[model samples]
Target: MKNLFLFLTLLVLSVGVNAQQNQIQQDSTSREKLDEVLVKAVRVDADSPITHSNVDKEELAKRNLGQDMPILLNYLPSVVTTSDAGAGIGYTGIRVRGTDATRVNVTINGIPYNDPESQGTFWVNLGDFASSTESLQLQRGVGTSTNGSGAFGASLNLLTDAFSKEAFAEISNSFGSFNTRKHTVKISTGLLNDHFEISGRFSKIDSDGYVDRAFTDLKSYFLQGIYKDGNTLIKALTFGNKEYTYQSWFGLTAEQLQQDRRQNPYTYDNETDNYWQDHYQLHWNQRLDNNWSTNIGLNYTKGKGYFEQFKEDESAAGFANLIEDDSDVIVRRWLDNDFYVINMNTTYKKNAVEIISGLSYSVYTGDHYGEVIWGSDLAPNTNIRDRYYEGDATKNDFSVFSKATFKLSEAITGFVDIQGRFVSYKTNGINSDLVSFITDAEFSFFNPKVGLTYQANQNNSFYTSYARANREPNRDDFKNGVTEHEILNDIELGWRHNTNKVALSTNLYYMFYQNQLVLTGGLDDVGSPLRATSGKSYRLGIEADASIQFCNSFSTSTNVAVSSNKNKEFKASIDGALVNLGDTNISFSPDLIIGNALNFFPAENLQLSLLSKYVGEQYMGNVDSEFSKLDSYFVNDLNVNYEIKPKKLFKSIMLSALVNNIFNKEYVSNGYYYTYDDTWSDANAVTTIEGAGYYPQATTNFLVGATLRF
Candidate 1:
C-alpha cells in the first residue's frame, strides 16, 4: 500500500512539472474573419436561418492541429467533449445538451452522415478532416425541416470550401501538448477563362496521448472543382479518410483505477481497435428564376473498418461449464467486424414557401471472427454463428422527407415537416443457440413536425416545436438474443435575440422515451452495450447560449444547460411493481454544463483568448447510486496569436499558441459496466456477479501553430 501511494504521488508530481515546462503560449491580439457555413436553410432563405449557430472559418483556425472536430465544438455552451487521450486532442467526442452524437443529426452538403442502422457518426473515422471544412453549423433541437433522417439533439451541417478563384499555395505546421503534431499543404488552380476553378488540401496528424498506450495517426485530403457563371453553379467536392489508433476502450474498476493512477483510460465499447473510412460527393446548384431556385446533390461513401480488443483471461463469468466441451480446453474468441453505407439528396426553394426534399437508401453487413469464442448452450456460437465468415449480412434502409416554410404574418413564421422511413433486416450467421431472427421484419413511421416562430421585435423571438421520432431495432439489437422497439417524442420551446453587438439563444425541451431498452444491470466483455427491456423515461432540460462584442477590441461567448432526467413510472422485473429509476442521471448525460470563450484584441494583427468549460454531475445507470455517480468538474484553456508578413514571397501569416486544461482538473467524463476480480475464476458465471463501471477525463496540455494565406 505504501509503495502504491508513493508511485501515485510521483506520477502526479511528474505530470505537474512536465505541464509547467510546456505551458501553452498566450501572445497575440487580432481577429480574423470566421468561416461561413452553407446549409439547406441558406439555399431557401436570404441569410442563415434562425435555427443555426455558425462556427465560421475564424473559429476553426483558432484550434491547434490534430484536434478532432468534436473537440473544436467545446467553445459552445451546453456542450462537452470526452477524450480517450486524457486531453481533448486525439480520439475525442462531443455531446450537446445531454444528447450524444448518435442522437445528433450530421449532414454534409445537405446529405446525411449517420449510419443508417446505428444512427451514429464516428468522427474518428475521418481525423483532421476539419482542415477541409470551409464552414459548419450546429442547429440545436428540431431545426428547420430539411432533408435526411431526423434532428433530435442538433443538426450539424458542414460546407466544404469551394474552389478558390485565384491560384495560390500555402503550408501550415503545428506541434503541441501530448506529443501532438500536424503538417498540411494546400493549393489552388486559378479559374480558367473565368469559368472553372480547382483546389485541394492534404493534411496529416499524429499524437501520443497523455495516458498510457493511447496513440493516433490520422491522414486526409480534400479536393474540389467548380464551374460558375451568373446564376448557375456546378461543383464536385470530396473529403474523408484513414486513421490508425491504439485501443483505449477497457474501463478500469474503481479499485484498479485508484490503484494504478497512470493506467490507460477508456472511452469506447471496444479496445485495441483501429479503423478507416473514405467518402465522395458531387453537387449542382442553379437559379431557376428570380424567386425560385434548386439544388441537386448526390453522395457515395465507402466505409471499411474494424475495432479489435484483447480479452484479459479468456474464461467465462457465468455458467462456464455449460459453454465448454468435455475436454475442457477453455476456449475463447475475440471480435473483429466491418460495415459500410451509401446515400443521396435534392432540394427546391421559393420566395414565400420552400420545399426541401430527398431520398436516402443504405445497406450494411458485417462479420465476427476470432478463436473459439465461448458461449453457453443457450446462446452458443456453434455452426460458426458468432464467427460468421468474413462477409456481409443483408440489412437495408429507405427514407423520404419533405418540409415547407410559411410566413403567416410580418411577426410570425411557421414550418411543417413530414418524413417516412422503411427498414428491412436479414442475417444468417447469427449465434445458432439464439433465435434465428431471420424474418424480414419491416418497420415504418410517419414523423410530422410543426413549428411557430413569433418575432416579438428584433431583440427577441419565441418559438415552439414538437416531433415524434420512431426507431426500429437495428441488426445489432436483434443479433444476440435481443430485440427492441420505440417512438421517442420531443417537445421544445425556444427564444432567440441578436443585435450588432450581442446575440442570445435559449431553449426548453422535454423528451419522452416510450419503449427504452433498459439495461438489466449486466455487461459483456469489451463493452458493446447489452440491455434487457424497459417501458419508459422522461428527460427535461433548458439550454442557453450567447455571444457579445464588447466594443471593437473584445468579444465574449457563453453556453450553458441544466437538466432533470428520470425513468418514468414502470414495473420492475424483480418486484413486479411500479418504481422510479431513482433520481439517477442518464449515462454520460451531465445535469449542468457550461462553456465560455473570451477573445481579446489589443492591437492590429494580434489576438489573445481564453476558454472555460464546466461539466456537472452524472450517473452511469438508471439506479443513480453513489457508485454510479460521476462528480462535476471544470477546465480552462488559453491561446495567443500574432500576424506577420515576410518582406517577400508569403504576404500574410499568423503564428499561434494554445494551452488546454490549464488547471489540470481530474474527473470522470464517461463510464461502463465492469466486473469484479473474483468473477474471473468462473470463466462464465459467478455468485457475486455485480455492476461496476468507469471512464476518465482530460489533463493539462499545450500547443503552438502557424497559419498562412495568400
Candidate 2:
C-alpha cells in the first residue's frame, strides 16, 4: 500500500511540474490514426469480407455498473454467458457459436491474452477492465489470422482508451442487488505540452453472490504514459487486479435444487480462491509515408494464485507422508507463472490494394504445487506449508501471417490470408492425484483463407469466405490420455444493407471438424470442464441482426441465431460395452438464441431501454439422454440513463439504473452431467447410472449508479 501511494504521488508531481509548459499545436486526426495503427493488423474494416460486431465505450458504459466482460457481451449475435455465483460478478464464462471459451481467441492490443497451458480466458483476473477500454471487435467463425493460439470458433480484440486532448477527472459509484457495490476514480494529465500524456484509473468492487457463501472482493488499477509526434507514437502501460472469491463451482444436484436453488454444499468458511495478476506492455508505432506503416509491441505478465479447500476423511495413500487414514485435511493449490510476448507488424497501401504482414512469438513457464495447511492428525515429521505434490511446465509459440485485399474489378474485391504456426510444450513432475505425469509435444500447422465481396448497389453488399484452422489440445487433454490435434474448416456467407435510418445483416456459416475435442458434460475436481475426442462433427447456422429507427425518439435492434450442431457416430461406453449413438446432438449446443433491445428517448438527455433474451433447450451429453436435457428459458431487463450538465460545480453528472431478470424467472443457464457403472445393481451384469448438477441464475435484481465528470 505504501508503494502504491508513493507511485501516485510521484505521478501527480510530474503532472504539476509540466502543467505550465507551452503546448505544441498538432492535428488531432493524425494522432488518432497513428493510435489505430497499433491494432490494424488484427482488425478489419467495415467493408471487409468478415462477420463481426463492434462495441464502443458509450455502449459498454450503459450496463457497466458492475459485471464481467462476458456479461457485457451477452447480447451479441451468437453468444451465451454463465456465472458460477448466479450473478455476473464472479467466475463468469462465455461461449460463441456453441463453442466454449477455450476456442475463442482473445487479444489486447495485438498481444495474446489466453493462458498458455489451459488456453482459457479468465475475465475475473481483470476486474472492471471495461472502464479503460475504448472499443472492441468480435469476429465470428475463423474470420481472420490473429496472434493467439487458434481461432477455431471466433476472435476478439480490444483497444485501450485513446489519450485525452484535455485534462479531466471523474468519479463513479454504484449499488446493486446481492450486496453489490462498485467505486472508481479516473484522472488524465491530458496532452502534456502536446507531446506527452499520463492517465490512470483505480477501481474496487464487492459482491455477496446469489449463492450462499459465494462472495467476491476485487481491486484493480490501470496506468499509462504516452508520447506522440507527427508520425511517431510510443506508449507504456500497466494493469493488474487482486481478487478473493469464495468457491461456488460445485453446482446443486437435482434434489438440492428442488429444495433450495441457492444452497451451497460446502460449509467451510475459508473455502475460497485468491489470485493476483499484473501485466506490463510497451508499444511503438510509426508511419514512414502515406503508403507504409509499422507497429511493434512487447508484453510481460506475472501471475500467482491459490485455491483453498477442505477435504473430509481423505485416504492416507492419496496424500504423501500421511501416517493415518480417515483424517480431515485442509489444502491449498498454487500456480505461479510468467509470460512474455513480442509482436511486430507492418501495413502497406497503394492504389486499389492493401497488404498486412505480422509475426508473433511468446514464451511461458509455470509451477504447480499443493501445500497442506492443517490436518486433524499429522505424522511425526510433517509440518505446515510442506508441498505434497509439485509440477513444472514450459511452452513456446511462434507464428507469422500475411493477408491482402485488392480490387478485382469495378464492383468486386478479392481477399487472401495465409499463416503458419509452430509450438512446443513440455512438462515434468507429480500431478495432484499423486501420479507421475510427463509430456513432451510439438506441432506445426499451415492455414489458408480466401474470400470475395461484391458491391451490388449503394445500399447492398454480399460476401463469402472460407477459412481453415488447426488447434493443439490443452494440458488437461494430455492428462486424460488424449494427444491428437483438432482441425476446423469454416465457410461463411453474408449480406449487408445500410441506409440513413435502417441497417440489416444476415450470415450463413457451416463449420466442419476432424478429431474435435467435444465437451463431456463433466468437470474435473478443480471445476475445469472435461472433454473427449469426437471423430467427426459440424455446426450449421444462420445469424441475422437488424436495427430500425421509427423516429428520433424511438428505435429497436434485434438479433437471432438458429443452428444445427451434431456429432456423427458418437460412441459411449454403457454397461461395460461401447455403443454408437448415431447423429447425436453436440453437448451444450443450443439450437436457437434470440436477443432484442427497444430504446426510447423521451428527452435529449434521458433514455430508456428494454432488453430481452431467449435460449432454446440444450443437451448436456452427446448421448442425448432424457436426464441430460436442460430446459429452455426467457429473460428480460430494463435500463434507464439520465444526464445533467450543471452550470457551476461540475461539468456533467450521469445517473443510470438497471433491473435484471425483471420477471423474476427461475432458470438454470449452465450445468454438468456424468455417468458411472454400478455393479451392485445386479451381480451378473453391469449397470450405468447417470447424475446431473445445475447452476441456477439470479432472479429479479436491480442496480443504480451515478457518475460525475469535471
Candidate 3:
C-alpha cells in the first residue's frame, strides 16, 4: 500500500509539472461560442445504407488500452459486460442489450470473423489486437444486412490501418491498475510517389491478472501494404497472437472462496494457457461509375492453441469422483479457417427518392483437432489421439440486401431496408468421438429482416425493426450425448437524439428463442461447461447512452442498461406460473450497468482527465435466487499529458501518464454455486463442489509511461 501511494504521488507531481498552460487570449467560458469538429470516421462501403455508430483511431486511444475490446465498447447504449477475472480489462465479456456475443455478429472488411464452429468470440484469444484496429462500427438491432455470422444482437465491423503518406513513427507506453503494462511501436513508409504505401505496428501487453493465474501476456503485430490511385485501390494485411494465464472456467467453492477471497478459489493448479491466430487478407476496391462502387475480399485464419490444467479425478466411472486420486487432464486443440466474400452496390443522389442496393456472398472452411494427453479413462493412461475426437467443417453464407431513402416531407424523412440470407453448414471426417454424431448433421437457415426510421425533430428519431435469425447448433451444442437446436426471432423499437453538444439513445428489445440451450449444471472434462436444449427463452430490456460536449476542451459520456432475460424459466413446478424471463432477470444479467468519462484541458499544451465506472448487482442463474447475486463495484482512472516544444534544430514531443484504480478494491466479476437443489447438509451440501464459483477482479495498480511521435 505504501508503494502504491508513493507511485500515485509521483504521478500527480508529474502531471502537475507538465500540465497544459492556459492561453489567456481565448475567451472560452467568458464568451458564448461553439466550435465544430466534423468526424470522418464513417466508411463508404458500396450500396449499404444503415444506422451506424463509429469510433475513430483517436477515440479508441482516448479509452482504455489493451486487448479488452468490450471495456471500450461499454459506452454503447445497448451493451453490458461480464467478467470472471474481476477487473474488466483481463478476462471479460459483453452482451448487446440482452443477447450474448454468440448472437452478436462481427466482421472485418465484409468477411466473417467468428469461429465457424463455436460462434462465440473469445476476445482474450486476440491479445493486443485492439492496437491494430484503425476504425470500427457498431450497428444496433437489425439495422443492415451484411456478410456472414447471424446478426441477432448487433454487428461490429472493423478496418485496419490503410496506407499513410510521408514517413512517420510513434511509440507509446502505458501502465494502469492490475500491474498492467502496454508497450507499442509503429512505423509507416510512404513509397512510390504516393502510389504505394506500407505500415506496421508492434504491441506487447503483460498483466498479473485480477484472478490468480489469470495473468495475460499478449503480443501482436500488424503490417499493411497498399496500392491506391483514382478509381482503384488494393490492399493486403497480416496480423494476430495471444497468451494468458489460465483462470480456467472452474468457479470457487463457496466455503473456500469465503475463507480465502484472494486465492484462485479452484482446486486445480499449474494452468497457464496460450492462444494465437494469424489472418491474411486481400481486398480490392473499384469505382466503376459515378455512383457505383465495389469491394471483393478474401481472407484465411490459422488458429491453434489450448489451456492445460490438473484435474481432480481420473475415471468418469460414475458421478462420484471420490473413488480415484486427483489427476491431470490435458485438453489440446487446433483449428484452421479460410473465408471469402464479395459485395457490390450503387447509389444515386438524384431527387427525394435516394436509392441504394447491394448484394453479398461469403463462405468459410474450418477444421479442428482435439486430444487428451493424460486421462485414466483411456487405456492404461495411454495418450489419446483422433479417437478422442477431431474434425473438419465447411459452411457457406450468402445474402442480398437493399435500402431506399425517401424524403416523405420536410419535417420527417423515412427509409426502408430489406435483406435475405441463405446459410448451409456441414462437418465430418471423424467418428462420433472425434467428429461426433453432431458433426454428421447438415442444416440450412434463411434469415430475413426489415426496418424504418422517422425523424420527429433534430434531436429525436423513432425506429422499429424485426428480424429472423437462425443458428445451426455450434460444436458444443451438437455433442452426441444429448444435443438440440438454437433459433431466435427479435423485434426492436427505439429512439435516438442528437444535438450540437449532447446525444441520447435508447432501445427496447424483445426476443424469442426456440430450442434454446440452457445450463443443465454440467461440466466438460476440462472445466469448460455443458448445456442442453430447452423449449424456449427470451430477453427484454431497456438501455440508454449519452455523450455531452460541455465545451471545446471538456466532454463526458455515460451508458446504462437494465433488463431481464432467461429460459422459459419457472417460479414453481406445481403452480407453473409463467415466468416472464423478463421478471427475475437473466443469469449474469445486471439490473444496472454504467460508465462515465470526463476530459479537461486546462491549457493549450496540457490535458487532464478523470473517469468513473460502475456495474450494478447481478445473479448467476435462471432463478435469480439469493445465492446467485453478485455485488456491485466501482473504480476510478486519471490521465494527464504535457506537450514539449523544441527550439532551433529539434522536433516537438509530448509526455503522458495514467494511474488506474486509485485504490485497490477487492471484487468478483462472476461466480456460481455447484448445486442449485434443496440439499442443505454440511457434508453433501457444499455450495461449490463442482461448477466454477467465482472469478476475481483486479487489485490496486500503478503504471507511468510516455509517448513520442515525429
Candidate 4:
C-alpha cells in the first residue's frame, strides 16, 4: 500500500516539475498524421484523448527474424503471449488485459483480419508480416470507433510498407534451436518515371518445434504498387501465405508432465493442419481543398484450411448411412471462406474544430465440411470425397461513425464520437453426427464516446474518457444457445509526461460488463475454446510504464499492471445440482503483469538488451477452486546485435542473437479443467471427478541470425 502511494506521488511530482516552462502550442490539426488512405478511417491523432501505443518499422526490425507477431509484442503492458510449440514459431496466442484473442479487434490497413465466423486472428496465415509493415497502433480499451467487429478488449491496426525513393535490395537468414530456419529476400524498383513504384518480398520459414513431432513449413509473399500524382494517391497490395504444421492441440496432464514433458499422444506421422490465405486491397486518396480530404478502399480475402486427425474406436452411429464396426479411423475437417469489404471516409479540418466520418460495408460467406478418410467398412463403392457433414454461413456487417474534436479553451480540448452498426447473420449446418440445425438472426447497436484533455504544460498532460461498447457473440456461441449480445461501460483516466531525459504514461480504468462471454477452458471438436456468458462482471486496474535514458550508452523501459477481475453471484451446475458460489474470480484473468527491458550500447554499432516478464497466479474456472489454480511465474531473456558498414562491397552487415529463458524456468502459461459426476458411488449419491490439461513452456533456447543489405 505504501509503495503504491509513493508511486502515485512520484507520478504527480514528475508532471509538476515543468510548471514554470512555456505552455504547449496547441495545433488544430494533428502533427502525427499519416498520408496513407487505408489508415485514415481508423487511426487516432497524436493529440487525441485516447490510450494507445505506436510501434514503427525501426523497432519491429529489432526482433523480426523467426517468431510470430505475438512474440514480438510480449513486452507490452497487460499482454500475455504463449506458443504451443514451446518455442516462438507455430500456433501462438495472445491475451490483452485478461481478454483472449477472439475479443481483440485486428485490422490490416483498415481491413478486418479476424475470421468472420470465429472472430479470431490467426497470425499463422500471414507469415513474416512484420517484415513488410510500416507502422502499427495498439489501443487498449474501447478506443475511437473503428471497422470490423467491436473492440471489447483492444484494437490493433497495421499499415503496410510505403513507397521508397531509392532502389534497395536485402537478404536475411536466421537459424536457431529446434532446427528452426528463416530465409527472406526483398527488392524495390524505387520511383519509376517519377510517379510509380513497385516493391515485393518473399519469405520461407521452417522449424522443428520444441514439442515432439511439432513442425511448421511456411511460405509467403508480399507485392505492392504505389502511384502518387498531385492531389491524388493510389495503392494496390497483394499478400498471402501457405502453411503446414503438425498437430499439437492435445495438451499434457500433470501426471504426464511428471513422466515426460515432450510426449505427444498421437503417433501418426500424417497428423497435421494445412492452410492458405490470400488478400487483395486497393485504396484511393484525394485532397479536395486545404481543409478537406477523402479516402476509399476496396478489399477481398480468400481463405481455406483443413486439419486432419486420427480417431480410435469410433462408433458406427456417428456416420451417415454407413457402418464402421467401431474400428479405428482417420478424419479431416475443412473450412473455406471469402470476404468482401468497401470502406470510405471524409475529413474536414477548419479553425479549431476537426470532423471525421466514415462508412463501411462487409460480406462474408463460409463453407464448413468434414470427410472420413479410412475406416473398417469394406465397401469399395463408397466415394472417398463424400462429406458426412456440410454447413454454410453467411453474414453482412454495416456501420457508420463520426468523430469531432473542438478546442474548449487555450489549454483544454473536447472530443465526441458516435457509431451505429447493423448485422445480419444466417447459418445452416449438419453436425458430425448427421444432426441438422439452422439459425437466422439480426442485431443493431449504437455506441458513443466522450473525452476531455487538459494540457498542463509543454511536457505534461492529463485526460479522461468514457466509452460504451457492445459485441455480438460468434458462431460457436450461437450453436451453444446464447441469444443476447454483451455490453461494456468503460471509464479511463490517464496522465502522460515526456521530456528529453524520460517518458512516462499512467492510466486508471474501470470496466463494467453485462453478459460478458467468458472462457470455460473447454475445447470444442475443432480444438477451439467453448465460451459461456457471465451475468455480471467488472475489472478495475492501474497501468504504468516509463522509459529512462540514464546516459548515451544505458537505457531502460518497464511497464506494470495490476487489476482485479471478479464475477458477481456466480453459480454452476455440479453433480446435477445448481450450486451458488457467491462472488468469484474470473477464469484466466491474472491480477498482475510486468515487463522490463534494459539496454546497453558499448560501441556505436553494438547493442545488448535484457528482457524480463512476470505474471501473477490465475484460475482456470470461475469458482476459484484450488484444483484449478496456476502459480505465478517469471522469465527472462538476453539479446545482442552488432552492425557494420563496409567501405568496399556490401552496404551494411548485421549479426544478432537471442537467448531465451536464461535461468531455465519451468512454468505453465495456459491450461483448462473440467468436472463431471461419478455415478458409480455407493447408494444413490453422486461423486465428482475433475480432469485438467496444461501447456508447459520450454526451458532454455537460442536463435542467431545475419543480414546483408546493398
TM-scores for every predicted model: 0.82, 0.95, 0.80, 0.94
lDDT (Cα, tens digit) per residue for candidate 4, span 147-256? 88998888989999988877888899999898999998999998888778899999999998888888989999999998876667789999999999997777788998
Better of 2 and 4 by lDDT: 2
Cα lDDT tens digits, model 1, 419-467, are 6666676666433232344546766666777778888886888888887
Q: Which one is best on lDDT?
A: 2
Clashes of each: 24, 0, 15, 0
Give the per-residue Cα lDDT of candidate 4 at 160.
Answer: 92
Cα error of candidate 2 at position 241, Å: 0.5
Q: Residue 637 deviation, candidate 1, in Å?
A: 0.7
User: In order, what lDDT does every prediction score?
Assistant: 0.63, 0.90, 0.61, 0.84
Candidate 1 residue 694 Cα shift, in angstroms, is 3.1
Top of the candidates by TM-score: 2
Ranking by lDDT: 2, 4, 1, 3
Cα deviation of 114 in candidate 2 (Å)? 0.8
Model 4 misplaced stretches (Cα beyond 4 Å): 1-34, 378-381
* Candidate 3: C-alpha lDDT: 0.61
The model with the greater TM-score, 1 or 2, is 2
For residues 276-306, could you state the per-residue lDDT of candidate 3 as single tens digits? 7787877776644333344556677777666
Where does candidate 1 stray beyond 4 Å? 1-38, 41-51, 146-149, 265-271, 308-350, 365-391, 431-439, 480-482, 517-526, 530-533, 570-584, 674-690
**Worst ten in a row by lDDT for model 3:** 32-41
Better candidate number, 1 or 3, judged by lDDT:
1
